[model samples]
Target: MNWIAALPMYNVTPELAAHWRALLAHVGARLEPWLAARGDSLALIEPDEQLERFWLRDDLLLSQTCGYPLVHALSERVRVIATPAFDIDGCAHGNYRSVLVTGAHVDATTLAQCQGLRAAFNDDDSNSGMNLFRAAVAPLALGKPFFSAVLRTGGHLQSLRALAIDRSADVAAIDCVTLAFVRDRLPELADGIREIGVTQSAPGLPFIASKAVPAEVPALLADALDDAVRADPALARRLKLTGFVRRPASDYASILDIERGAIEQGYPVLA
Candidate 1:
């Protein structure tokens, strides 16, 4: 059978996208012979469909998904492979936090001061963008609307633009890795944004494979990731990747706890 793979979560710019493709190709090369021995093959094509649909495919051999969906929508259908540990300020022990950013022009220095202002988030399913932000603001909401309006920007890049360039929104919650990439590769977007606060840390995105794959596949992929980093030190540094660390699904249950905490506080949505 032919399987597929993707590393779509952090491809914030064209340069970053090319790097991720190269990394994926390298891992695929390492896995090819092993998979071929078992009469299986892996494809390095980028998924052309929506991520949720791509994740659900039976032929998905490798992919990266947010912790929010891993706990809420994908726990049973996909098997946890490993979490990539990044060498960045907001990351530690394979866990990462979201940085709350506001435009340079905005005078709100803290989250509390920004109450009732416009807000932007990448997607509701995004742990960094929505869940963490919801958890952070839930206590302040007190069962009432906090932001005057909430915009769904579809991606961190767009959310950043909504906060800095267009000024359509006053603040956004962005993944720390994405912020680092923008600072390195897309500096113009990073220029006028200010990190006002950070959300509680949780396990970063986890690599996942379809449950139908062989039991050995997860460890194989983890080894491939380590090999990929060693083989290309320059690329790994540019990607801010240190190595892959195996983490159980239970480590991600805290993400649900964050959501439940918000809902219990009557702040289910990011409003």
Candidate 2:
């Protein structure tokens, strides 16, 4: 239990959280049979723990983080283990996109129609929530901002709720994987979640280990990820996990380009 592990981003509902626990347990079990050979061990960080606090912990053996944060803030502090390949509707292999969704009552069906409407986003640093959506909106903004205002919901699920349930915002760009999970697991939150537009796909959230770990850890992790998916078909189904990829760090540079592309278009922020 000296090392930490978590898959916090997509656990937007209780069912998904339980699935994540199961996924972790399966991965941990795979490790237990071999980790001792390297004098290493891992354990799930309590699901209820404040996950953001573990981003830089030395004991953080495994975790998933948004691509934006991985490029913008965490590149130096962590090494990517692998990118999970989800079998969700809006994702392909290890890449995912964001959907611009509006209330079913809203007539808008395209990004242009949603112009000047209030936008809800999970966070400024979120890749699928804000950065890619910002990029999608940048070209549409010839010289004026698209959304009249922007709401900063704390996370992807919260952003989905802000538009789908609370009605606090007219629209929001939700992570496709998160949306898929909500649509399937949390029917209440998906009631009016209609997708109007989808952003360009990019590398999905990646599993990252602190750089303090051994140089060989990334390959070890990649192997374990593939093994876990192959060894436990039921667990893979629970999480909609199809497989994983050994994506190079350079593959994530596109996220920075999207952020920079938006800034260059005179619409740096979502608003």
Candidate 3:
């Protein structure tokens, strides 16, 4: 059977997808002889059904900003190959921390002054939306309640849009990477939104494969990815990828640890 790779749709567009396909094709072609030597062929699938196949076929998956839930869901079946936690940089907190805005036309000072405001969460299972967000606000809510209301918006882009369009939420926490993606792909929406503050940095997503696959698969994939990074400047620039760095399971354990700490501390921000 041909082994497949799945790409997430969150930060990807059709044009960008085409670019990725071409780049992957180059990498795949270079790796084909080796794969064929092992009686396997490589294929890249579309974001929709292909994603399902990845989950089912025990192939590899690549995603950004999809750590928490994906890991939770697939932990028993897969192992993380590599991640970019060390290289991925977030926006400076001095300028772009998450804010609590109001439809009543509240300024930063006024919003900050408000004792209790509504908050919107993209998903309870997101690292950026939950883990980093909790770490950012936990200090401030040391002895007081932070939000009067909290609503789940399903995804980051939807949460951002909900904060602007619904008039129900006073604030929403967004990831810097997602913010940049929106700025590049959906400029109009990005123009209206403002970042109030930034959260602490956490690791980004990992390229994961089924635990059943031979260990050599991950080693080979990692090598091909490193070569792709070294040879293709356009690919590196487009993905903001510095390079693939090997990560052990312990690196991701901190994410689960943060979530557990927040829950134990009775912080509703992550719940």
Candidate 4:
């Protein structure tokens, strides 16, 4: 009965927190016998902390970008229970093209004029912040440097704020999912920023479990997720989680392929 849940850092809010509690309660109620036998309790791990630890534990690990490094990181420790390629549209921060300017320093049209301008990325491990952003610029960076400089800001919100306040970056890719979340909850920032371009669609988050968990764990996790998505209409609408779609390991290989092609073509700024 030692059940654990982890969700993305960006999507955590009071309502979402309540939603998760309810979902976990449903799961716990359904697995009460197992819980009694195991003499354990259910726990919820916040996305920003303990995600790596949860992946290592014989419990469920949930988050976005369940790609190469994460899957490989957990392969020996856990088994991927159910992965939805296009699960929840957690935030509008994925592929929305935007040159977050410093109080009218540059507009979208002006930013586009500066083709080889510097940009800031959230992280190297991020698919939407780094990988998808690289792919968006790959075709345009023929022989010239697409980005004069690239800074790793560690998080999407930091990347956005860096462009607006720091003046160190010319532009930054903002994910639509994060945008949506902020627009609905934190409108001040949303009102100040504007989108200049858009990248291709990126995949959604995945749900996982430990390899040593009961064989029925995967099925139970998937069923619970499906029920949660169906039962929580308000939450679903708030997050725009259309539904869960199953995916395999090969689905994320394209990200690496994009990385390889960019490196081979000498667009190593993205790498």
Against the true structure, whose lDDT is highest? 1
Candidate 3 stretches greater than 4 Å from native: 9-12, 47-57, 61-65, 85-88, 91-106, 109-115, 142-145, 165-168, 268-271
How far residue 97's Cα lies from its native spot in candidate 1, in Å, is 0.5
For model 4, residues 1-271, the per-residue Cα lDDT tens digits are 4567655544535776665556555555656666677786667666555456656665553333344345345544555554432232432322123223322345545334547666778876666677667766766676467666888998777776666566677667666556666567665555545566666654444555666677776666667667776777676665566556655545555656766776676676563
CA lDDT scores, all candidates in order? 0.91, 0.82, 0.60, 0.58
TM-score of each: 0.97, 0.93, 0.80, 0.78
Off by over 4 Å in 4: 12-26, 47-50, 61-68, 71-77, 83-104, 110-114, 165-168
lDDT of 2 by residue, 1-271 (tens): 3677888888777777888878777777767756787676787866465455577778887889889888877877788889988888667769999988987767888988988888888887889888988889899987577888889988877877777788888888888888888888788789967888789989999998888876776776788788888988988987888999888888999998888888888988777
Count of clashes, each model:
0, 0, 5, 16
- Counting only residues 3 or more apart in sequence or on different chains, how many pairs clash (N, Cα, C under 3 Å) in candidate 4? 16
**What is the lDDT ranking, best to worst?**
1, 2, 3, 4
Residue pairs with clashing backbones, model 2: none
lDDT of 1 by residue, 1-271 (tens): 8889888999888788888888988899999899879888877877899888899888998899999999988978899988999999978889999999998888999999989899999998999999999999999999999999999999999999998789899999999999988988777789979989999999999999999888888888889988999999999987899988888989999998889999999998889
Off by over 4 Å in 2: 37-40, 47-53
- Summed over model 1, clashes come to 0
RMSD of 2: 1.8
Top model by TM-score, which number?
1
Rank all candidate structures by their TM-score, best first, as comma-separated numbers: 1, 2, 3, 4
Clashes of 2: 0
